[model samples]
Structure formats: structure tokens, C-alpha cells
Target chain A: MTIHTKTLKQLSQGLQTGEYSSQELTQAYLNRIQQHSTLNSFITVTETQAIAAAKQADALLAAGNAPLLTGIPMAHKDIFCTQGIKTSCGSKMLDNFIAPYNATVVDKFNTAGMISLGKLNMDEFAMGSSNETSFYGSALNPWADSTVPGGSSGGSAAAVAARLIPAATGTDTGGSIRQPAAFCGITGLKPTYGRVSRYGMIAYASSLDQGGPMAQTAEDAALMLQAMAGFDAKDSTSAQQDVPDYSANLNDSLKGLKIGLPKEFFDEGLNSEMATTIETAINEYKKMGAEIVEVSMPHLKLAIPAYYVIAPAECSANLQRMDGVRFGHRCTDPEDLNDLYIRSRGEGFGTEVKRRILVGTYALSAGYYDAYYIKAQKIRRLISEDFAKALETVDVIMGPVTPTPAFGIGEKTADPIEMYLADIYTIAINLAGLPAMSVPAGFIDNKPVGLQIIGNYFAEAKLLNVAHQYQQVTNWHQQTPKGFE
Target chain B: MSLTTDDVNKIAYLARLGINTEDTESYTADLSNMLNLVAQMSSVDTDNVAPMAHPLDTIQRLRPDQVTESNQRDNFQAIAPQVEEGLYLVPKVLD
Candidate 1:
């Protein structure tokens, strides 16, 4: 039997009926990954572990007892720690380090019998909008080789979009997951701040980092989210809420659902093609009996400014653990204690990582603390309050995921401003700790553009419902890049 | 409100990052450009506004003060460039 856009449901039915076993499915993905290494979508493939897990999944199936995610293959962002796997957050600093334990999220997948494909590549320490900063190099836009797959979850989105694996995990620290999903034409979700566990996730920003699923469809994300989300005593931040059947109302029509379109997201500097695409998506929602209303987020423009401060400040503190003396890449020659510290860090980190560390250290400095770092945090509350107020008026918010479709690989690398601008449309959600998703809306210049749908806290079900309802009518998510096929 | 080359070097040093004094010129230029945008926050009157570092202000209910981390001292020090007994090795600080 051929694998043609198989969902978890289809794959499970096949595995249960003995049409194919977990090992066969794992091998198929391994073969695809080998064939598509040119895409640079994966940093390290956990072939040994994946095969071992597949064998276990097969045994469970034979025993007639299997979990919801049994034998379902998934990929993880490199930022997540996998026991004995090289869990580099796409930076050279930790390039040689192998985690001694699995992250809470990784253990969940393993316990559910989900076969691991490998660790997907990401931006250096989950920074940057394009995947270019990765030490392993950038993931190419499968849709258009000339462009980049948006990042820092670029590899996670690309692998799923390329069908190397049906779905993958991505951590969104200020839109890392959603932006890449938008560029790669897949469904990616950034659940609320505490919706998923972050323990053992090599965190760049403790407060903003959130892990969620990137898959071919909203229902697929829902199924993965079912396994991914819940309270974990291991993670202090993990919510104490029970995991809902995300697929329960996935078929629920969007009738009478109120969606707010923040005027700020559509104002000046918005791309015309992107605007048309989002307008088309919003129009489709209207036809589905959803109400669209204009909303104002006064703090919208403040998000980028606030995020640059808070994310980097937190990143600066989190990365302090990697001093080279503590099991990471070390420099060749060092005179003394000071030399060791300097050379180890300077050589270990990438340009972007250093940049953030510098910025973060600056913000948190004593003299400048109140002037910059503390001020940004005050603005953060306002940003979340803006989302809270908007939610009072609408069930969900819809807008463009990014200002444009996937850009050329090296197009904005030289200009940091251009790179940061791509995330302008998505960063505020992280500040608000709101759940958001990027669904393929349509194409602009033959590259996919995603319609961003954001929901209030704990609104994962509604976002998935809306995305699922939209996917039933539109085939944008179904289209694949030609040459990859 | 903008930072100078001296400011960049000072911040880098304070952050415990060793920087080549010569490279500070270029680092200064790039940092100045980036920091200039960030300087906007200075204009906002946050004098009385309480700093909100996290989305939710709940004091983290950390799992009891017990040591949750495993005793991976041996495993952790396995790949250390320099290790002695249970401690990570570093050069002598004082002469």
C-alpha cells in the first residue's frame, strides 16, 4: 500500500490491520529522510532509538494494547533533550553534548510508543526568523528552493511539509514554530505558556518558550497535542489542567464563532498578496457562519520592542550554563581562567547568539535595568492585556502569519532588521502566552502563505476546530512542493 | 540614550564574555544600531508601572525544595575537558 497523505487515523488503522508494522513505517521515513538530506531539514537522525521504539510499538500492537500515538512517527526540535542524542539547539556551543536524559515532552512521545524520526534543526538557540543561523546550516524552502523555510523551527515544519515524517514537535519562543509552519505550508501550534512541559528543553527564554505540534492537518496537530500537552510535575510551569480531546469538536462547524482582526496586523507595511490571502481566509470563515469584527490592540507595536528585551534577557541568563568547562565545545588555547571563559564562549556561540546575549546582559545590567529591561516587562503585561481584551470581543483572532511568504535563504540574513520584521506579525502572542496556529491560506509567488489564527488562553480546541473546519473546504495544506515529490 | 563603543565593551565584560578589544569597534557599531531601536522603551514612563516579567504573575510552585535532579556527577563530568573528583576543573584563580 502506498502512503498518500496518511493521517494518524489512517496509519493506525493500517498498523492494526497488519498492512504494515511500526518498523516498516519507521523505515519508510528513514528512507525519505536519507533521500531528502539535501533539504537540510534534520540535524541528527535517531535511527537506533527510533528502530528500538518501533520494535516496542510492534510488540504492543501484537499484544492488542497500543496507545493513541503508538507507531506514529514524530520529529523533535533539536532544542529538546533526547537521552543520549546530540541535542544541540542548532548552535556549536553544545554541538558535542549528548543529553543524559529525555525532556518531559520526549518521554511522553516515547511512552506513547511514537517512533522518533530524529532531532530536527532549528535556529541557533531558537533565535532568528530564518533558519540561516543554525550551525548545521539552514533548512531550504521545499516549496521554492530559492527561499528559506521560516524558523527557528524551520526543520520541524519542513520535514512535515516534505512528508519525511507526518508530524514533528517545535518550540515556539516568540513565534519560532508558527512562522516556520507558515513558510513551509503546514499547521503549527504554539500552545499557552504552561500548556506543555519545558523541562529538559534547552531553553533560550524561560518565559516565552512553548512546545507544540506541527503537522499536515489541524486534526493531526490535535491528535499530537493530545499526547503532548498536560500537567507534568517535572515542569514547574506545566499547567495543572487536564488534557482535552482536541479532536472532539474538530468537526464542529465554525458557525457563529467570532474572530477579531486586529487593525494593527493589517495596517501599513502589510504585504498586498498576504493581505489578499488572509482576506480570502477570513471570507471563507464568514461563509462558514463565523463573524469577523475589527479590533484594536493598542500594544501591538510594542510587542517587538518588548520581546527583544525580555527574550534576550532571559536567554542571556539561561545560556550562562554553557561555559565550556561544563561539557561543551572548548577552545584550543587559553592562558588562564579569564582566557578560558572568553575564548570558550566567543568560539562556541554563533553571531546571533552572541548578539542576544550581549543585548540581554545589557538590559539586565544594574544601571540600565529600570530604563530597558524592566520597562519591557511592563509593556509585556499590556500586550497580553490587549489579547485578553480582544478575546472578550471575539472567540479567536485571524491575521497574516508573517508579512510575506517564505523569503530567499540568504535574502535577509545580512540585514537583521529585515529578519526581525518577519516575526513582527507573530511575536506578540508569546508575550500574551496565548495559543496560536498558522494554517496554509494560499500561495503568493508560488510559495505558501499561512493565515495565522490565535486564540485565548487554553483555546487550543477552538483554534484546532477552526483550522480543521477550514482544511475540510480548502486544499492549500494538501499541496506539496513539486521537485521534492 | 544610545550606547558607545566603550559601553558595548563594558557590557560584554560585565556579562563575563571575553571580547577582543579590536573587535569591539565592529561589535559596537552593530550593537548601537540594534540598541537604538530598543532605546524607545526608555521614553515610556514606567517609573510607577510594576515590572511584569512573566505572563502570569503566580509565584512558581516549585516541587518541594528537595533535590529533583539526579546525581549525574559522574555522568556529567564524563565529557568535561577537565575534572577532578566530583568537581569541574578550572585554573587556579590567585597567584
Candidate 2:
């Protein structure tokens, strides 16, 4: 098998057995990344740093006490701050901003002896559903050249799907990771809020943003999460709860697992073919002794409207720090401080980002605060309650990740609302702050579909176990795109 | 409710974002469409529901008033768009 096609586990074993040196592995990935540069999956390629780190990892391996991820190649979403690297988050505002310190997640990965290839591309400030909002340009779906790979984790998903890198980190706010992972035909987990530290991940919406792993399989995702999931004193909102070993239950039997099917998820907006694809995947679970339960989450419909308000409102507050004076972009010949703030931000951000910021400003402004922001928060509570009530009756929830397969590049760009609707099936989980994953289920019109499996708070292990079992029964997750294979 | 160009301009001002005159019309339409989407929230009555600020609704953990991080002013200011002599330089506020 080609080195690029090897799963994280197989690569770890290869390293242990001296089948291939870390330097050789890192070089292979770097070569693939350069060869597939048309995918636009990376913003920065740290050839020197990756090789240097791999050499260090080789020394550790020779000493005989390295972690499973040691010497294994991976990339981080540009959203995470990597000290001395340009952590742009796919925005012109930070195009010149090199991080002064590592984000907690980056520090953790480095500590695990993982060699980072470089920074992956993402939507500007993690705003758009399609990665077209990225200042670095859109990352093409490896499945098809004309379609989007999904965003703000678009680069991360595309890179992993193309096997340019084994895995990459992605942050989700309103289904960024899972949606992109679905579109790209990979396994991605968005852990329950606070499960991963967000100290150095560029803040989009502080309350909703979460960092997680995107890989080719549930087992690989579990391995990445094992290194990523932990509490950090730096992120105040990070959960103090101990993280369970995600790999412990990967092979666990799915017998008697109760999977909830939310009635709202199969509404008229759902693509009929996509529905059939998800049904087939669920049928496979049923054959494995899992039971399907029909549940109602009426409030699921409000997730997008509520998310649009809360996420933007939090983002407006979080992003206020990007003014010209201290860091990020600055306008030349500014007349005054206000001019610097206005013109700098105007020159820095993209259209979608500006739209969200304006919407947030309006929602929080006088007279509209109660009418918009507060109302959305209250609806958020209802959405969370819906999940809480449903989880009481089922071990996990299953549904289609996106309404349809990957849309063409410019398909939904003109209509922001249409793009927002793409995330309808997945946003409720973030509102409820629950752990969820997207596992490749089947294909439609030559593109892939994902079966979203959502679990209660801090149930990442259970989600991984369920997904891993499904992967074992089927080869959907193992299928590579046409040219990539 | 739909936002007018006037409303969009006001919002852009409040956000400290300079919206070009040419883009204001589009921004108005887009922001209005988004607000219309957000208008759906009014259909649900959350009269007794408490606002959820955090997903888990957990209170923030307060750390003791101790300096955990050493000063890295130089390291941080190195990326500043305009900085000199350990101070971030901006237009004079009191001239």
C-alpha cells in the first residue's frame, strides 16, 4: 500500500517496526501535498519544520519510548495558533500575523511527538459553510473538482480526504468539521463543548466553537482525540470532567444500541436520495442488533435561526480585539483611531464575515437585544432541552449530515440563507453542546454521504465506538476518491 | 424585518467596519434576508425558558489573582502592525 493510504494506526505500527523512518514518512506526505497543490488544502507547508520535527521524533523512537503519534505526520487547521507560523485562519487580517505562542491543542500535539506538516486553510474567522470565504481561495472537493469540500474546516477535510496528510485538526461552530467531513467522505468528531481547550484556536464564537479531529476512520479519529481531549486551565470554559479513553470501546459490540431518528431530520427539505443512503446505513446497524427508535425534536427547526444569532453575537464580541492598533492588519495613513478601526477591518475581512459582524452588531444594539439575541438564547435552551429529552430514550441519534451531497463551488455562494440551511441537520448538536460525528455511509451521484451519529455530552467514546463498528462492517470510510486512490 | 441602507450603514458604523457605498445595497439585502431567517425565532414562545449563555450552563471557574504567565510583551508586540519602544502606537486620542 502507498504510504499516503496508510491509516494512523498502521503508520504507528510501521514506525515501531522500523518499516519506514519518520523522515521518510514526513517526506512522502510533503511530496503528496506539493503534487496535489491544486487542491488548495494548505495555507502554509512547513517542510523545514516538519522534517526537523520528524528527525527529533526519530531520535525519540531510537530511544524506545515514544507515543503512538510520534513521527506520524498531521496538519493543523490554520485556526489554531502555531508559534512562529502564520496562523491566518484564512483571513487577510492575519495573513501577516505569525503566532507568538502555540495554542493549547498545538502544544498538546507537539508534546505527543506528532510532526505537523503545516497550517491547513479554513473560512475567514470560521464564518462560512462553504470554504469560498477563505482568503486563501476555496479548497476543491477531492471527490469532484467542481464541488466544495465544505468549510471552515474545508482544507483540513480535503487534505485528509486526498490522503495528503493522515489527519488534521478542525474546529466546528455550526457544523464546520462534521459538514466538511461529510462532504469530503471522512470521519470527524466534534466533542462536547469544553472537551478540547480553545485557548489558542482563533475565536469565532466563543460559546459554540470546538476543536476536534478529522481523519479517514473512526479508529484514527479516536487516536487523534486521545491526544487532543483534555482539560486546560487556560480555557475557562473547558470542562473539568475527565476524558474517557476514546479507543477503549472502538471494537465494542453494537448489540442493543438504541439509535434515535429525529422526525424533523427527515423533513421535506431533505434530499430523497440522501435519506435513502442514511436509511441503508441505519439498516446495517439494525442488522448488527441495534434498535432504531423514532423520536421528535420539534425545536430542531429553530437551530439555524438560533445559531445565526448566538454565534454571530458572540463572534462580534470575540472579534472586537482585531482592531488595527495591537495586531492583525492596519490601514495606511489613518486619520484617527476610529479610521484605523473602520478602514483596517473593512480592508481585512471578507464579505461573509462583514455580513455576520453587521448582523451581530444589529442584534446586540439597543432595542434589538431582547428581540433578537435574547430570544435566540432562549430558543437555544429549548434546543438543548430537546436533545436532553431525546437522549433519555436513546443511546445516540442518527441522521444525514447535509441535506444533499457536495454542491458545486458557486452553487450557494450568492444566497447566504441557502448556505446556512446546509447545516440544518447538524447545528442542533452544537447548540446542545453534545458530542457528534460524521461517518461515511454511502454515495450519491458519485459523491459521498455521511451518517451523522450524535451522543450525549462527553460521550465521544460511545460515538467513536458506534462509528468504528459501522466502519468495520462496511468499507465506506476506506474508499478513496478517484484520482487520490 | 428588512434592513434599509440607513440601517445597514448604522450597523456598519457600530461595528466599526467601513462599508463601501457600492456594497451597502447588497449588504442591506443580505442582512435583511438573514434577519428574516432569524425572524423565525419569534414563532416559538420561550416565555419561561432561561437564556443559555453556555452550552453546559456551567459557571466560569475563577482562578486566584496570581500571575501565571511571565511578561511576553516583546514576543507579542513583534506582530503588532505598529509598535515602538514597548508601546503600541495608535493615532493620538488626546491631541
Candidate 3:
């Protein structure tokens, strides 16, 4: 049996039943990664490390003491710092940077006995919506070579969608995980802001950044998230709440489940074809005993503006540590301190990253601080309130993950505004610090569309239950790319 | 609503990012487009709404001051471009 085709749950059972040794399974996935190198999904493949870890897992299985995730070869978004691995946040600035420590999320996964195949590619500093901004070249969508795999977490989504790996870790500062998952037609979750520890997961926007699981199935996502979530002392913003077993409620029935369809989500900017696809998926939910209600979030339109400001402002501050003196790329010849700083950052960062840093600096500058930064903060409050008020009336919010399915790679790159608009539907949930996910709904023009599920703060399990229940009735999540299959 | 070339240069200088002279025109235009997008925030009336700094609206959790980390200066500085005596070397700040 091909190990790549098995879901995380099925793989766990297979390991437990001696169907395949973890070493063989790990080798199978490594071989597939070699076979699909043209996808550009992986930036660094840890072949030696993965094989050694797989051997350890095989020994554990021989002792009948294997963890659920033992020997499961997976890829991590390059944003997560892996000890002794090159952790390029898809920017030339970090192309030479080797992380000295593992991100807390990486530590958690490693502790659970999951073997990492390597680091996946992403948008530079998790700044862009399309994978095109990656310094390592765009991660091509497995479905269509010309189209983009939605980014910041684009590589993670693409790898999972193409069945290169069963699951991968992704961070969502603003719809990075969910949007890419939508574009790739996979299951991706963005947990409540503090649900997952952000320590060593290189900060894009400290307040908005969150790490979650990207997998082919919601049930697989549930298993992966169970290991990734929880508080850590390393991350000061980490919540003090207990993480619920995400898989516990996966089989829960959707009977009497209340799903809110945000009228704003279906309004202008949503593609007509995507709307029809989302509606069809909602009807399936309706058939599964879910009640759909219309909810209004008037300030939702302002989310993009507020996010563009606040996220960059935080990013400008967070990325300041990358000065030429410390670990990261540095200019070869610098006339002075300012020249070193300027040239290093200029050469290291990509166009999108520099654009953001410039905008962020301008917003937080002496003259524009109140007019831009403070004003945007207030808009953020209004946006969060819109979500809070809506959640009070509904159990969860449902919407289209993107205006359209994965567009051609170079289509939106020329217009930054148009590119930013691609995340319009997914950004508000980030501003509100709510849990949300993208699950495969249906295909439009042979390109997959995702149904976005937005849940209240810490409502991750509920969102997974909704997606898992839906996945049971539909085969959308199982449709792999033509060539990859 | 739009940033002039001078404004773009000043922002880049403050951000410590050097832009090729030829790219300045595009940067000026792109930054202006982003600013125009952010200009949407000004139209909303946020009179009573307080500026939110954090999502949870919680105070910073204070921990007792103590040394919690072991010395990894050598390991940490191993990746630095230039390090001497455990100190990162940058162009001199003071003449």
C-alpha cells in the first residue's frame, strides 16, 4: 500500500497494526518528495535526519510503545525555526540563517514523535498572499502548474494537497493558513490568537500571528492540531487556558449546529462561481442538520485597511532584529553603519517585504502615527466588535475563503492592492482573534474552492467538528491532483 | 493620500532599507497605492472606540526577574556575520 495516500488517522492505525514500518513509510514519503521536486513545495529536505528519526520510530514500534505520530514524515513551513536546519522565512535576508533552536510548535511535534521531512517554502516573511513573493521562487500549485498555491503558507498547503506529506505546520498572521488551504483545496486551521505558542515561529505580526495545522482532511488536521496547540512560557502571549482534544469532537453530529452565513462575505467582491460553490456546500451542511442564519458584520469591510496597518506596524518592530550585525545575511562591503543596515536589509528582503516595512514605518512615523496607526487601531477595535456581536447571535460563521480560486501565478503580483484584496474575507477573523478554518467545498473550473468556517475565540474543536462532519458526507477533500495521484 | 519621492526616501531611510534609484519610482507608486488603501480607515468614525493594542485586552503578565536561560552566546553568535569576543561587530557607532 502507498503510504502517501493514507490519512494521518489511517497511518496511525497502520503503524499500530504492523501494516508498514515507520522507516518504510518515511522512505515512501521521502521518495515521493524526490519524485515531485518540480512542485517547489520544499525548500530544505532533511533526508538524513528524517531517515534516522524513522529508524528510532521503528525501534519504538518494535517495543510496542509508539506514539500516535511516531515516524510520520511531515514538512514545516520555513517560518518555524528548526534547530540546526536552515529556517529561511522565504526571504533572501534569512537564506544563510540557520536556526539555533526549534520553534515551540516544532518541539511539540518532535516530542510527539513526528519526523520532519524538511522546511517548506513560503512568502517572504509571511507578507504576501500569493506564493510569488518567495525568494526561493513560487511554490507551484500541484493542480495546475501555472496557478499559485495560496501563500504565506502556500508550500504547506500545496504539499498536503498533492499528498507529498500527510500534514504540515503553518502560521497565519492574516489568512496565511486558511487562504492557502482554500486555494490548494485542503483543510487548514487558524486557531485563536494565543491558542498556539508563537515562540521561535519567526514573528510576522506578533499579535496576529498564529501557527496551525494544514492537512488533506479535517480529521487529519484535528490530529495534527492536538499536538501543536497549548500554552508555553516561552511565548508571553501564549494563553493560560487548557487546549481541548481537537479530535475528541470530530465525529460529533452537526444536528442542530448553528452556522452563520455572514452577509458581508457573500456580498460584492465574492466571485459568482465561488458563491455558488459555497452555497452548494452550505446546502450539504443543511442536509446534515445544520441551521444556517444570516448575520451582519458591518465593519468587516474595514478589516483589510486595519490589518494592513497593524500587521506591518508590528512587523516593522519585530523584524528590526535582523540588522546586519546579527545572524542573517549581511552586506559584503559597507562604508558605514547606516550603509550596512540599509544595504543588508535592502539586499536581504524582497520587494513585498520592503514595501511593507516602508508602509509600516510611515504609519508609525512621527507625523503619521496618530492619523494612520492610532486610527487603524481604532478600526481594529470596531472590526473585532463586529465579530463579537455576530458570534453572540450564531454558533459559527461560514463564508467563501477567497473571492476566486487559485489565480495564475503572475496575475495579481503587479497590483499590491488587488493582491491584498485576495485576503478580504479571511483577514477579519484574524483581527477579531477568532478561530477559523478552510475546508474543501467543491471545484470551480477544475480549481478547488474552500468553505471558510469562522468560530469564536478558542472554538477550534467546534470548527473541526463542523469540517469533519462535512468531510464525512463529501469526497471533495479526497480529490488529489491529477499527476500527483 | 499619496507619498512623494521624498516621502518614500525618508520612509526607506527610517526603515534602514536602501532602494535602488531606479526602483524608487515604483516604490513611490506602490507605497502610495497602499497608503490609499489604508486611507479607508480615516472615513470610519471611531470617536468612542479605544485604540486596541492586543487582541485579548489583557494586561502584560509579569514574571519574577530571574536568569532562566543558560549561556548559549557562542552557539547564538555562531551564525553572525562578524563576532569578536562574543560581541556582534557592526560598523563603529561612535568615532
lDDT scores in order: 0.87, 0.94, 0.91
> With candidate 2 superimposed using the best TM-score fit, by how many Å does residue A104's alpha carbon deviate from the native?
0.5
Q: Higher-DockQ candidate among 1 and 3? A: 3
Provide the global lDDT of candidate 1 against the true structure. Answer: 0.87
For candidate 1, write residues A1-485 as lDDT tens digits.
45736877788888887799999999988988999999999999989888988998999998988876799788999999988889889999889988878899998888878998899989999998889999999998889878989889999988988889999999999899899999999999999889999998888899889999999999889988988899988887778888888999998978899999999999877999789889999999999999989999987887888888888899999988888797887888677877788789888888888888999999888887877787899888877888889999999999999988888878897778668767888999998889999999999988998999999888899999999999999999888888655
Shift of residue A345 alpha carbon in model 2, Å = 0.4
Task: Show the lowest summed lDDT stretch of 10 residues, model 3 chain A.
Answer: A1-10
TM-score of chain B of each: 0.74, 0.94, 0.91
Per-residue C-alpha lDDT of model 2 across residues A20-67, encoded as one tens digit per residue: 999999999999999999999999999999999999999999889998
Ranking by TM-score: 2, 3, 1
Clashing pairs in 3: none
Measured by TM-score, how close is model 2 to the native structure?
Answer: 0.99
lDDT, candidate 3, B1-95, per-residue tens = 87789989988999998899999999999989988888888788998989887888877788899999999999999999999998989887898
Query: DockQ of every model listed?
Result: 0.67, 0.90, 0.86
